[model samples]
Target: MDFSIISENLHYYFDGLLITVQLTGISLLLGLIFAIPLAVLRTSRNFILTMPIRFFVYVFRGTPLIVQMFIIYYGLGQFDFVKFGFGVFQEGFNPDNIGNQTFLWKYFFSEAYFCALFAFTLNTCAYTIEIIRGAIESTPFGEVEAAKSVGMSRTMMLRRIILPSSLRRAFPAYGNEVIFMLHGSALASVITLMDITGAAGIINARYYAPYEAYITAGVFYLCITFTIVWLFKKIEKRIYAHLAPYVDKTQKTAAVN
Candidate 1:
C-alpha cells in the first residue's frame, strides 16, 4: 500500500535484485559445468568412479543448503586444516588490534557471499546431476542401437545423440532447478549477501513497514518466476516438436483455433 516507501528505496531493490540474479546465474553455471561429467560417471558401473560422485550427491542433496553454507563459512573455521591452509598469506594479512580472529579466519569465514555461492553451486549440482542422469537413463535402447546401426561410435553416439537428446528432455526439470536456485538465493540474506531478501529486510528496518517492504520483494520474485516459466515453455515447444507424428495435426489445429 505504501508505494512511496518502495519508490524511495528503489536503488536498494535494484542492487539486491542484481545480486540475486548474479548469484543464481553463477550457481547454475557452476552446477552445469560439473553436473554433466559427474552424471556420466554416476551412470558408470564402476564403483570406484561412481562412489565419490554418489557420496557427494547424497551429502549435498541430504543436507540443507543453509547448513552447507554454515559449515563452509563457520564450521570449517574451527578446523586447523582450513586455518593453516594458506599460512604464509595468513601471516601477511594479520594486523594487531583485531580481536580473537586471525587473518586466515577472517579471510575465509568473513566472506559470506563466497561461501553462499559455493554452497549453492554444490547443492544445485547434486540435484542437477540426478535430473540429467535420469534423463540419460530414460533414453531408449532402440534409439541407441539405431545410432550404432548407422555406424556411430560410442563416443559419437553420446556426443551427437544421447547428450543432446538427454539435455532436451532434461530441460523442463532443469528449468525448475534454475527457478529454485533463484528463490534459494534469498537465503544469502542470512549471511549478509544483500540479495533481494536482504534488501527487503533493510527496507523493513528503515521504514518500519514490513508489508510494503516484503510485498515489493515478493512482486520482484513473482516477475522473475513468470519470466523463467515463459522461457522454459518456449524451449519445451521447440525441443519436443518432433512429437508431431503421435499428435493429430487436425485436432491440434482445431484446438488452437
Candidate 2:
C-alpha cells in the first residue's frame, strides 16, 4: 500500500491528533469529576441516594455513544428553548433560526467541540462511576474495622482509607475507560470536529487511498493505547507498591513449600 499519503498529509493528521487528544483529555477530566460523587452515592444503601445515580448510569451506559453525540449535536437543535435558552455568545447570535447554527451553549455544551466533550464526559462518567463504586464495595471489612479500632472517624476513614484504596483498586478499569474514550473520540468527526479520524477520512477522500489513510490512523490509535497502558502500569506499580512486600513474601513462601 502507498504509505506516502500519510506523510504528505502529516500536518492534517497532526492537527486532528491534537484535537482528538484534547477532546479525550477534557472529557476524561469531566468524567472523573462527575463519577466520584456519583460513585460515592452509588455505594449508598439508601434508595433515595442511589436511585437517581442508578437511572443516570443506566441511561448513559445503555445508549450508544454515537447516538448520544447525535442527540447533543443534532437532536437538541430541534428544540427552540434548548437552542436559544442555553446558547450564549449573544453578540450577533441569531435566535430566530438555529438552523443557521451560531451558538451551541458555551462552557461545555456549545458547537462541535463542546458538545462532543459534554457527551463523551457523560458517557464515561457512567462507566467510571460503576468501576469506582465496585472498588469502594470491595474495600475489605477488616480494613474498615482496623480503621475504626484506630479511633478513626468516619470522615477520616473515608479520606485516609476508603477513597485512596478505592481509587487504587479502580485504576485498571478506569484505564480501560481512558483508552475507550480516546478511541470513541473519533466519533467527533461525525459532528465535523476534525479529530484524528476525521483527518484520516479527509486523507482517504483526497487520495482515494483508503488503506494508506486508515493504516496511519490505526497506527496512531495503537500508539496511544500502548502509551496509556504503560502509564497505567506505572501508576499501578506506584499505587500498589505497599502490597509488593506481601506479594514477594508469599511467592517465596510458596516456593519454599
Candidate 3:
C-alpha cells in the first residue's frame, strides 16, 4: 500500500475531478431543462404528444448507461455515412473514396467528449422525465379540483400551482438523481475521457498500486457524496419549512413545567 504515489500524482486526480464535475453538472442541467416540457407532455392524455416521449424515455431508461455511451462513441463511427460523410450515401458507393465528412460528425460525434455528453444528457433526461412525471401525477386531487373550481386555465393552474408543488415534492428525488449521475459519470473513463476513475486507472497502471490509486479515487467520491447529501438536506429544509409542524412556545413551556 504505497500511498505516496497518490500524493505525487494528486494533480492528475484534481484534473480528473474537474472533468467529472463538469460532465455531470452540464448533463444534469441539460437533462432537467429538456425534461420539464417532456414531463408535462408525458402527463397528457394525447397519444400523439406522449407516445414518442414515452418511447424515448423507455429506450434510454431501459438500456444500460455504459451501452448507450459505447453506441454513441463507437457505433456511430462504424457507419460509412458518418465516417465518409453524406456523399457516400448520396452520390456513389466507393470503398476507397473518403468523401466530405459532415460538420456534425467531425465536430461532435467523432469526439469522445461529445459522445459521452450526448449519452449522459439523453440518459439523465429520460430518468428526470419519469421522476417529474411521477411527481406531477401524484399531485393531490383536491388541489386540482380547487384549481378547476377557481376557473384556472390548465396552463395557469400548472404554472401557478401544480408545477410549483410538484417541483418541491420532487426536490429530494431529483437530488438523488443528481448523485446517481455523478457516480455514473465514472463510465466516461471507459471511453478514455480522463474522468476521476480514469485518473485512478492511469495511476494504478503506472505504479501498480491498485489499493492506493483506487482508494484515493473512492475517497474523492465519498467526499463528493457527503457534500451532495449535505447540500440537499439544507435545501430540503428550506423548501419544506412551511410543511413542518408548528409548536406553540407557551405549550412547550407548560409541558416542561
Best by TM-score: 3
Per-residue lDDT for 126 in model 2?
94
C-alpha-based local distance difference test score of model 3 = 0.92
- What ordering of candidates by TM-score runs from best to worst? 3, 2, 1
lDDT by candidate, in order shown: 0.87, 0.87, 0.92
Q: How many residue pairs clash in each candidate?
A: 0, 1, 0
Candidate 1 residue 124 C-alpha distance from true site, Å: 0.7
Better model by lDDT: candidate 1 vs candidate 3? 3
Predicted candidate 2 versus true structure: per-residue lDDT over 86-164, tens digit per residue: 4544566567674654344444456788889889999999999999999999999988999999999988998899998
lDDT by residue (tens digit), candidate 1, 1-257: 68898998888989998999988999999999999989988888999999999999999999988889888887876665455444425656443334545565666456887788889999999999999999999998988999999999988999999999899989999999999999888999998889889999999998899999999999999998998899889988888888645656668777677
**Per-residue lDDT for 1-257 in model 3, tens only?**
77878999999999999999999999999999999999999999999999999999999999999999999999998888777666676655674744466778878998898899999999999999999999999999999999999999999999998999999999989999999999999999999989899999999999988899999999999888899899999999899999888867768777677
**TM-score of each model, in listed order:** 0.86, 0.87, 0.93
By lDDT, the best candidate is: 3
> Judged by TM-score relative to the true structure, which candidate is superior, 2 or 3?
3
Give the clashing pairs for model 1: none
